[model samples]
Target: MTENQILQVLDKYAKDYNFPVLDNYNFDLAQCRLSVFRDDNEWIIVFEIVGVNPSLYISNDIYAYGNSVESQGLIIGLDDIVSLPNEEDLFDDEGNFLITPFHLDLIINSEPLIIKPTEGEYLELGIQTELFNPTKLIRYLSSKYKEKFWLEPLDLLNEINMSEDFKLFYQTDEWEHTDEEKPSENKFFQSLAKAIVLNDKNLIQFKKANTHWSNWTWSDFEKQEED
Candidate 1:
């Protein structure tokens, strides 16, 4: 949508629902806000959206973000969250929790609205061997983000242009990512694709018997002796 149009939607939502937003917004103030009401859905995921150019990956055809999050973005008072996470468990402590700011995104086009973390999101928070507070927090948000999208009957696509001018706060091309293609290449996708064609149908396979060390267990003389 045009910047103006996107702002209008965010403006509408800011009025329609109350989602947790950053108190530490470091960039120029958000051009606008996007929101989702507390719901029982488990879909507000955390993952990187931007990366080095071209190697860049995205879920929707596009995404929208603001300035660099290192100097920016993040958190809730926590106790006020409307969904399922217990308030007592969210208390901030000096240890066992890394209460840092967050970077976020608004997924337009696909679902009615999805507020995902572009940075500082730890998806494995609840499942890790150590139960991190970030995990609990993310899980809580994800669950709350689970409302079905408002795409079809709403015909949101025609109404929104997503704008050509928005910029990413950041993408972890230098960091990690979730499960998908290029197992080894998932982190820095370009590194692997540059080294070898990942999606190539003629991908080469290696067999130990074809290497010079393949003869380490025996020699011609040993074969002759066997004969």
Candidate 2:
């Protein structure tokens, strides 16, 4: 059918449905192309609009001509669309139907954080050795330190630049606080204490002390006391 012929068909439907034709275009999907007829296509067409703040409405269908049969289908408003028709035949479809546009009323806005387990392991050890409680460490660093430094897990790993020895310390329990070992003498324990007292979020400098150590030096103990 010609473009003019298609437009005539769409006009008839628009009048019957009391819908005004806004615009039309051709859509392509996969390897196929089809014509899209629209009546307010400029308006955002949201298919699921129940929970949406401002609902959207779509008023067109996609149509493609085949050798034996002409196929027509509604364009669903979602991420999974594969093809759209060309600009010409959009109004050539035989019928006019009103379809609810997909509505994604994304109300909550939040940034996503990607955490790696390997990086998390190192970070957990670094914080623990510094004498901060694990839970408190994650919370404080995530809120305070991370906010200021904008340090993500990968950023933390890159900053530390630990050697194989430090990596091994993280692998082993050299920094973990045990019942038998008091928090005062242990370097890891003291670091945790200092981190807690001073509220330090500098994971880069903190990971510098990743080593197999039985105790902290007098200076380290003094730092915690002053903090």
Candidate 3:
């Protein structure tokens, strides 16, 4: 079928299903392609945009361009898709590789939501580490990471970035505390910075120390006498 014909079908579904229009949703029919299907009750639309967001939207026609290519019955049975090139196969022209640092996951009321943070987020994190002020850092981070009743975990980080209050807080300096009082503050901040950059376990250790969420402490590491 022609692109126009496929679009007409999608338009019908958009009206019937009330699929939301994505922000700045525009695509070129010649360059990009899509696949559409319904899994259970939800509509899934997958995009194949080169060097851009490869997304699967739920009940959204924003990327639903056409009917997916029909699968032919396999001539030879294969247990895995290892024949196809994966994202790991991609590399730069200069041969230096790019890697995804971390993916955020959350279980909200028993449903799992996962998302990868944008490159801009990593840049912002680097700036935050550079401008680190130990005394106000916790309060600053708390204001950003505070619980939101309405937000899905995927939306929370974006919401934090959008907040005008956070922008002001990020820009201002209010460090009045002495280094003597919190001697370990710099080291703690360093660990936190390293954790953010490397997406390591150091962040958890730092949070446990600072927040006192559990009763765990240095004393917990005390070696018990061998029986």
Give a tens-digit lDDT track for model 2, residues 7-64: 3333333444322111111211111111111221110101110000011111112221
Give per-residue CA lDDT, model 3, range 59-84, as digits (tens): 11122222432221111111111111
Identify the candidate with maximal lDDT: 3
Worst 10 residues of 3 by lDDT: 166-175
- TM-score, each model? 0.18, 0.16, 0.18
Q: What residue runs in model 2 are displaced by over 4 Å at the alpha carbon?
A: 18-74, 79-227
lDDT of 1 by residue, 5-99 (tens): 32333233334332122221111111112211111211111111110111111111112122111111122111111221222222235443433
The local distance difference test score of model 2 is: 0.24
Cα RMSD (Å) per model? 21.6, 31.5, 24.4
Considering TM-score, which of the candidate structures 2 and 3 is the better prediction for this target? 3
Cα error of candidate 3 at position 179, Å = 52
Query: Each prediction's Cα lDDT score?
Result: 0.24, 0.24, 0.26
